[model samples]
Target: MVESLASPWRHDFPQLLENPQLHYLDSAATALKPSAVVEASRRVLSEDYGPIHRGLYPAAERATDAYEAARSTLHRFLGGREDDCLVFTRSATESLNLLAEGWLQSVLVPGDEVWVTTLEHHANYLPWKRVCERVGATLRVVPLNTDQTIDATQFDDLHPRVKLVAITAVSNVLGVALPVSEIAARAHAVGALVVVDAAQAIGHQRIDLATWGCDAVVASAHKMSGPTGIGVLLARRSVLECTEPLLVGGGMVDLATAEQPVWAALPSKLEAGSPNLVGAVAMAAAADYLSDAGIDRVESHVAALTHSASEALAQLRGVSVLALDAPERDHGIVSFNLDGVHPHDVGQIAGELGVAVRAGHHCCQPLMQALGVDATVRASFALYNDDTDVDALVSAVENVIDVFGVR
Candidate 1:
């Protein structure tokens, strides 16, 4: 069993302690925030709460500085260059919608197609579908192989009409880690922009926007052990310059006259209204905590747990684990369905046994339809998870399956 390195922040997260009965295996859906993140939110809400970029009071100045500092920290965390733009939104879904409506809608013309994988979450798929419908663009999917991995050869087979490729770095349901860098390079060769949904990969993997060379990427703060109601959008400045604003209000505009109007630069153009100031500060603190803990170590720990989970779960009769049977490495998500049993029932059983796992389509109905299953039980891991958690999950699953029996 691989152990996590000594991390000071590890001591600060009280939720890490096992409940002797409860095991949290749903970090992919949402993670428990550390004390630092929690205190950061409280401090923002109580100590220095005000409208940023519009006030001159001391409290407002502090709020403005903290908010912008969060931006800078995220920029650094994402390895964004000076020419990159980071837009704050409510969630990863909102960020993707902003891109589909703002950037892709304005740039992609009629008959142009957007290439996406079948493994995408609904958040990535629906927005693009809407944009394609509105702009008279086509929606083409890159089908997955029987192993539940993307067919890399399909990229070359893409139609010349393809103008943008929106993909997930790691699938929330399939747990497959997609070949995003290769896809980005190939798509760019055909003059197509790439928008990656890194919501499941951000806190678990090292994402270098420069190396990934995508046009834009989105992630939610809550999945990264931060606060909710705040998501991040990272894009190339040139690409960001070509997009329109989704929301028009407060600080996003530079000058507004009845006859003529001008919007602010890159980021401000995309970020409208008061913004999630407290969420941003807390997210930045969470990012800092992850950075200090060493993302590589954190990733390794979670990967180990997931790998162990696959092995242990497979030992149980009438159980099947996706991606593990394949030769490819999967992300932290482990999705499965027991024979002759509903996923919701399995989830309920596990929950009663003190294992918190996600049930249902996991917000990926399209993918779920493709898989020929209505729902799946998914157990995802995080840095705080250890082998004991994996053992607990395996034990809980065995108990659950025994009650239902194999079909």
Candidate 2:
């Protein structure tokens, strides 16, 4: 067991509705912002706002510096090498689209296969599917085992014809962490590039892009205690250079003429318009706050919450917790279903009792279908959650089941 580490900033959050007994467990859907992140955005949007990268005004230069510094912070956080380039997009969905529309089209040809997992979020799946649709390629789905982890037996099926292997670092619904480095290595053996969706991975675990050696990865800032409308696409410089730009706009161009247009270098080439400078600055502040709190400690705290919630949920009659197979799958999320009770009902009941939880298909309908359910009630944790919050959740769920007369 990891030692409990204190998060001084926990109390600084606005406490949502400010009920003394409020239990917030919907973090996987979207994280609650720390006061710093909220205030950072407020300060910029109100007091120091400016357009970045295209203006010569004092505020614009300041905004540009702050925004690019956010990029630098992200690079350092991911431990990206000098050869890595970071592309900012609207969300993880857009980031994946940017890659599929750009990088995959440039490299993939007829008969090439891009391997994806059945456990992917639609953001990761559909873009690759579109690429295959456009490029006359195939999208091969890697199967998951009965235990819900990626079936390693399928490794033999990968071959040189496989141009890319896209997988999620953690299943948003299942909360299971895939063997990303190992999977990336296997894909490379067949000369395939790997793209990891780390939208759920960053705050829970450390990500070293250089060591992972995957061709690319995507993450959303909103899911990691930052502002929404900003996501990152991390790519090796060589891989990025070969990717065609999907959106051609002002910031991404070096020289433009009627006859032909030249795109800017990597990183800038991918960011087409006036970027979300305020959001990026706020995201960096959030990242800095988390770093000060220490990721290992934050992870340990979340693990304790997950293990407790999983165990508590499993003890309930007719309730099944997802992602209990791998001990390493211990992240902040706890997804499960109550027998004879609708997931939406569970969410409603929890909400009525001052407990916030998520219900419905959590953007992974295939995974939900595979689990033999229409949807689930997900209780995701963050550093702010404590034993009191956990107890409230368990009690609220029990009450919900009782009210529904579910065994």
Candidate 3:
């Protein structure tokens, strides 16, 4: 057995300890929530629950304060200068759709091009695809290198006609960390807006929208140990100012007349109905928890775990680890296929052994096609996971091979 690396802050996540028999390695899909975030969300439902921006009662006032304060907390957490630039949505997928329907569909014309990498989740790919189809715009794909990373050399494909570049900061399947800053610069040079899908990177890396040089970035709260119903979309004030509201309702309009309707300001314009106030509070708590623990330390710990796990898994026979050539660069996600065993079978056997791993296309069917496979078993790490989790996963895979009678 390999020596296990203990997580220093594992105590913060009660779910990890409460379920002693389960080894969770599906953090790429969603992370287990911390106690602090759970408590914060509970407080909102039990004590300070009220509709925000609707009433003048004490509950409403307090709820409004908490809701707006949560926005400010995220603004600071993401190194955003303006709170109004951050729009809260139901999930990262919704945020991307908001950008697609509200911004891209409105601005894109026939013959315009939107460039995206093959490493995108469906959240990033499908929205652009639909928008391009609607507007008669062309969707261009950036190919990947042999190592499963975006080929930076092929960025010359980004021409002057490219209106936007939608890319993921980290691949959900391959775990390859793309050069966002470089891509942003290249996209900007061509006068194209850059939108980063940071769903997988937010919890594992430090995000500074101001310095990243991207026009917009989106992430799901659940992916970062927060609640499920809330997500963040951070954009420049200028960009938010230009985006048309995707959903229009009572809260989003300043004045609605029979003749002409005026929309509300930046964030409110995008947030239509009653917002997810409790989810916002819970996500703020999560942001605070992560910030207090130090993002750099969390990243370092997960990176070490990823490297060790990758090294261990590669040694096993009939195991094909994707991007094994550069395990150190992966953002805490390791995906592989067992020879002569279907990914579904491997996942099922691993699940029966008390290991929870995600298997299949992982919402990236195009990437699966590129990799010449229909699916893969993905073991993703988070701050709450330790070396024992990795050991459990590897042992479970060995059990799968043994049960299948694979050589």
Candidate 3 whole-model C-alpha lDDT, 0 to 1: 0.89
Candidate 2 lDDT over 1-407, as tens digits, reads 22343444568678653655677888888888888998989988887778887779998888888888899998888768888888888888888998898888888899999999878998988999998989999998777787778854566678999999999888888778788888888888989988889888776667777788787888899888898999888888888888888889888888887478888987888888888988788878878878888888888888888888788878888788886776566777888988888889999989999899999988887777777788989988888887777777888888987898886
Tens digits of lDDT, candidate 3, 149-174: 77556677678889999999889987
**C-alpha lDDT of residue 301 in model 3:** 85
lDDT tens string, model 1, 1-407? Answer: 33433333445676765354557889999988788888888999999899888888998899999999999999888878778888889999999998888888887789899999888998999999998998898999888788888855669866567889999989888677887788888888888889899899987888778888888888999999998899999888898788888899877788987566799886887888887899899999999988988998888777777888887787788787766665555568899888888889889988988889999999988788888889888999887766767877888888877898774
**Per-model TM-score versus the true fold:** 0.95, 0.95, 0.97
Which parts of model 3 are misplaced by more than 4 Å?
A: none
* Best by the lDDT measure: 3
* Best-performing candidate as measured by TM-score: 3
RMSD of 2: 2.2
Which pairs clash in the backbone of model 3? Answer: none
- Residue 249 lDDT (model 1): 83
- Lowest summed lDDT across 10 adjacent residues in model 2 is found at 1-10
Clashing pairs in 1: none
Poorest stretch of ten by lDDT in candidate 1: 1-10
Residue 389 lDDT, candidate 3, scale 0-100:
90
